[model samples]
Target: MPTPIPPGSANETALLDLLRRHPRVLLTGPPGSGKTTLVHRVATRLADQGQACHCLAADPGLPGFGPPGAICLGRWDPRLDEGGGWRLETIEALATLDSARFRLPLVEAVRRLAARTEAGPLLIDAPGVERGIGGAELLAALVNASHAGAVVRLAPENAPDPYAQERVALGLEVLKLPAAPEARHPGHQLRTQRRTEAWDTYLTEAVEQSLDLVDLAIVGTPPPHDVTAAWHRRQAGLLDATGRTLAMGEVLALEGGRLKLLAPPLGDTPRTLVIRDAMRHSEGHLGTARPYRAPYPATPDEPSLRLPLQEAVDGPRPTLRLDGVRATLVNGVFGDPLLHLRLRHRKRSLLFDLGDPGRLPARLAHQVSDVFISHAHFDHIGGFLWLLRSRIGDYTPCRVYGPPGLAGHLDGLMRGILWDRVEEKAPRFEVFELHDERLAHYRLVAGQPMKALSPREVDDGVLHVEPGFRVRAVTLDHGTPVLAFAFEPDVEVKVRKERLDAHGWAPGPWLGELKQHVHAGVDETVIELPDGSQRTVAELAQHLLLSQPGKRLVYATDFGDTPDNRERLLRLARGAEVLFCEASFREDQAEQARRTGHLTARGCGEIAAAAAVGQLVPFHFSRRHVDDVGELYEEIRRHFPRLAATPGSDPYSEVD
Candidate 1:
């Protein structure tokens, strides 16, 4: 009589080889060794490899292991008894040493388990016996009678139970004494050995199942928090093939082998990175969050260490280079139809209302997004012909807003008699007429084409737009109905002193983001705090309401002797950093100025003083006293000393 061995053990493999047949396998192990799990793994591997195998778990709770007619039994819970058969138990179940009639259930359960198809090798997870139990003796009896050929033994992981060991020894002695029952079961055998190698197989499979790797490059992968850092590490070498790393979110200045990215650092890493040898351009980059594409090869033949030169500044965003933001005036006094305007942005330089009718300058040919008309008078829009003829490839469409009849006026201008001798295709013209009705604006493309827009007619209101600044329009009665525009940048500064103090913070790029958050509304703003927490824009605003201040600018022009109208203008212009007004006459001609509905030099100063503005600039003057402009200025200065001619002679001298 020997203890049955667990399958997958070295000793059992040798014993099975000696028996020349598959034996009824019983695997036993300590609590966490996964003996039951190992049985399923082996069965599944054999089935998947095309060897049909029947698996079963004889549980009292379940009639048998899961569904029928399958290569492997799915899953089973053994607690529910299906048959009214006698309960089966080994010596461990007989610790109370019940009457002989009670042993009927134990023998019945064992008989049923052994009766289950001896067609293939049976794998069983043996239960452990209680203290002082004779498990080996009972197993030996069942094996001798149940045709469990070539019995193999397994050892417990921990120290074996001394009581069970003694019972097994006693059983062996009783069976070897020749008084044993002549077991009718075929090929019956027994073995006992201290071999626990089967547990290793189960443990190995469990480890592999717990450790698995998966690819995360697919679409559903969650976005990483440190996107900036991730991009720099993963995309830097790939995108920056030129060996010249350019800051994607900032402008960089290159001078004398020094490189400087316009944006400052965030957290620890610089928000803008610069490569020393990067070949530079005047227009580095523009717009928000634009990806960078390297324009040079990594091994450019002549690699000079071209870098950005740095300049110390105090503002959040600084002007790194000058393009064409130049201003010139042709006539400041005397009603002359002459004017010039040049505005430059990061992308292009635009010149508007150029009075020169001959060959136009290259800057004047660039596309213009807007045209602010002083009036429909010939002098202000004299360059209309050159603008209509200078159209080139892919120019951003232009819109010119003017008084009521702007559409007809432009159509007539483009269809002027002088165009008969012209030899080139006419530039595309899109005119917008501003009427006094609710549907106040309408687009008139190339004269005949027309499209109506929502009625947004206001004598004085702000025109909101996306990327550009806001335009505040004021109607000035310059003979005819004239409108003047004031462009204000969208950036607004807001303070969060309490939050800053709480974190013991210093001023940096975080403040800029904070300001953006404030303007973008509560939902849009994300205020990252020093302690890794974030507060919305609304929260930040309410926290430090006193520290934040708002700024404004006002533009007023073409006022008659209407005191009420002038008063309103003065109020709007009050406390403004810059104020632009018209000085169309001298103080001596008050009656004439009153009749003409325009502001004289003295009148401009009066308004500036009354409004308490910081700076007063007078344009759109009458040519009646061009040479005596000094006299006009002297008259204005005599009353309001703060109103001065722009630095030198007059900045608006060309606005005649």
Candidate 2:
């Protein structure tokens, strides 16, 4: 049963009908227009009818609207209790909002509620009076929710409510839905001036005086007209140039190269149109329109290259994998202080580092996803300038990650170099400055810096838990704080291949799936063998069959041998078939290594021996020891005895 619809005014019933049809609703009006009270009444009605309805207030400081059928969730209670019930909350807890700074958290909350409800209805009450903050935010919230599988609803009455007609119009525009001719505002009236001739003369003089470039600089330029056509022409010219060098689906410089486009929507072709820059750029004009078009490139190639998103609204987080090799090698040295990891799984092999990449080693230039940097050290990041300007990789966005300085660093880099290139080459670099405490589970998307990831933080950790494995990071002694990571698969193998085959079970990809299903506690997992045989997981277990522990890999570098550091390394590297350590120095250069607080080949070997690791492979060698790399390897082997002597190859080579 559902609670009766809240009725007092005719508009209330109409709005309730809209809410019934559309689960996601953004109700906006002037202060005291009853947006909050209306939302609460509707929620109460839904609850009375046995439906799961939650009305979350956009403000944290606001008092609770009532009790248990609806619980108030604030910073104090972020997680919705594991029960079929409604929970009220501030927008921050419900979403990833930074109200004071005007950052909205709609996507994160929408994703969580979507997962919990199986497409149940959710109503968000936005702060209606803070128009500057609330107007754009409410608009964005509606847009994002619609994109994420929620049906959106709105009230467009204009007599008693404010901005209602405009809000409805904007929603239709954003959703690309057909617009309904709205009723006119009942009491709206135009102000008339008594001295019309005098006003006309004053306006004529103002228009004439504002046309000069110098005056425009001092007083700011006017909106779209014959005078601003030149600016549009120049912009179109640059976008044409950009299309020549870059491909479709790639990011580009826009708004004087300060913004990064994630991926252009389908069917739009590249052509420039002069228009007002969004919030990031200064307002171009008030009460005026400007020419705008989808200047972004839209080619057939773009659609084929776009990464497939998972069905779940919370986009898939794909880690770098080598495809054939369990480990992908990080290479390259010319760029900034960033290390490079070349992924071997996809058509494009990506380079992860920050540095000047001049004519990307032929192998990397044609690849689709390249240049994801780790941090912002100039030595690591300087090469990005050349890469961005070169128009290589079809101008595909090169994603970057680092601490707080990333966004500013990228902005400065672009502004210092080629800001106007936005019209020519779409800005291809996207930066994210990680702030963990402020946004527990929100990671700014590659292109959409404004939206944060929806995953909730389970612990004080950056890596989220996956279905089969967990990723963990530890601080390394890099003089500067740096982290090393490891991935541990949770599945354990209990039966040997020979034993399974002896029991007439055939081996195939499906067998692996069957094992996973069984390990996940699926009781009736039936495996079909290669010879058309079938068997239950219970039967296999009855025969003492099970899974073995999965593989373990650890990466550690830029650390010295402090007792705790050594112990951490030992535990992480213990039994690892392959261990990669920083061999910045040789045994003879131990003094230099100690002074620099980096590991020598001998020191790495010592640590490997102490940890009882199976193999020690040293890297991060100093340029001074380039010629003596072999000798250094031999010296390290003398101490560890298990150092593998396999000749290392340039992992970034495309030929392999």
Candidate 3:
């Protein structure tokens, strides 16, 4: 079975064409070869066209091989069996078994699983293709028993392959699938850490399934622990009454008579539950386990590079102010960004995106009265703990406003901290969740626990309204929910310098009083001038005070340049005096930027142009382009010729 000259298209199209010809295809490749990925991709693509496909794991010798809903017939990694992965002694004991006994049951298990997968095409994900010594016989056994129509080996381009020729000699049509560059494995430790997160994410919503002890009469392990618990923990197979695999479940917690299982939706009550310690799943979860990473030159025994606090610091940025707002990047352009903003000669100060807050100048931290969060990405929001911890004794409320789910995320951030034992009061936090329709509010007292406050319905996008300014928020297309803010100052009023010079009063209290009266809009209010003379507020406004539309300083970053979000962002940043946006990538990687929910350099310009902003300040470049942010600015200048030709070279001045 071979795919015909394939129509040029996505990998999905190519895989589907091959699978259409070969009903039972064996995906045989080494560890981290992306064989499991191709199988699931084919199965999912066929499933969309009303063609059902069954994923049969040839064997599960590893803990994270089975994608959710995959049917693994043979025994899995011993670490996950009846004795939990935590019980290393039991797992070590099981790993010492003879190769024959381990290889024998797999044939029977594959035969039994084959009968149930007859309803649709079979996508076989074969495991253990020469990862260790004495692994060849097990691989041979699985290949011979599967009786697949075709075998596809995923490997490097032009790489020497032994299995391709061997499988072809066995009368199997062979295809060479090259590995993707991004698919290069990070390492074993990184993979385990990644799997731990996957497990945590899956088990977060898992419910308890009560297992009657009598159902395990067939396993015959011992009291206190079911032998099947081991296999189920590795990859639990949930089956229907007809013994069809419904989904794959991950055993998270196992107490007496109750099993905490996290599986994909099975729809109805699963009639047969199969766990793998010593048992085999006769039958199915949607996400396959994440693909394995390819090995690099770095030895596994080598000490891993760890990121320490000093490593994250990129030093301070040159002081810059846009429209009286003193803007200083707490972390340099390439570092974890913590933008510090304070109104010159005014009490109001704010921290935007709290990245490496520990490095933030102590002077600035004390003045930060508010924090505006963009999103919860580690690079964006990682230093919030330092911020919260720093402001522990500060009694004044430090309001934190961001998109929805911020309160819960904050709780998770604070979980490791001992709240009860703390003597000092944490900064009083008023957390606000910005939604399109309304703002969900919550409050955390200095020493007390975080609790929800009443919700406030806002007609427009206004999240916080203060005497001097009001903040309007719009949701951005970041991987997580992000809120872009516009700080719209109330009608700006300033004393006319020429008028004061004309009066020759040397700029005293009269100037301040005139501006105050003008701001109040009190026409009849009389302000006593120098030399015992008085002027009406209306007259003072005409001669001395200058009033104009308030400065709208907008903050938007770490978001994708998508159509929907662009429209919302344009509205939020309409006519902004200064617009700070992210240029995480260059236009050349625009597709990748959009995929990652980040913006290209030109993306920032497009946003600035669309919003008709007075000044476009683009920062937050990806570290991959650290040596030359010139490329980012170059593409940005294409769309926004008005933008500075070079990075950090902005000529835009404060709008009067």
Give the clash count for model 1.
Answer: 27
Per-residue alpha-carbon lDDT of model 3 for 417-531, expressed as tens digits?
6677456565667888887788888887544667888888976888777655687888877877888888887878776677777876444445555655555556798876655
TM-score of 2: 0.37
RMSD of 1: 33.1
Stretches of candidate 2 off by over 4 Å are: 1-325, 328-462, 492-508, 511-546, 560-571, 574-577, 594-597, 645-656
TM-score-wise, the better of 1 and 2 is: 1
Estimate, for each residue in 480-551, the C-alpha lDDT of model 2 and write its tens digit.
544454545565544566876676543434444555565567758786555556768776555645555655
lDDT of all predictions: 0.40, 0.42, 0.59
Candidate 3 TM-score versus the reference: 0.46
The best candidate by TM-score is 3
* lDDT of model 3 at position 399: 84
2 against 3, candidate with superior TM-score? 3
Arrange candidates, best TM-score first: 3, 1, 2
lDDT of 1 at 4: 62
**Each model's Cα RMSD:** 33.1, 23.8, 29.5
Residue 540 local lDDT, model 3: 75
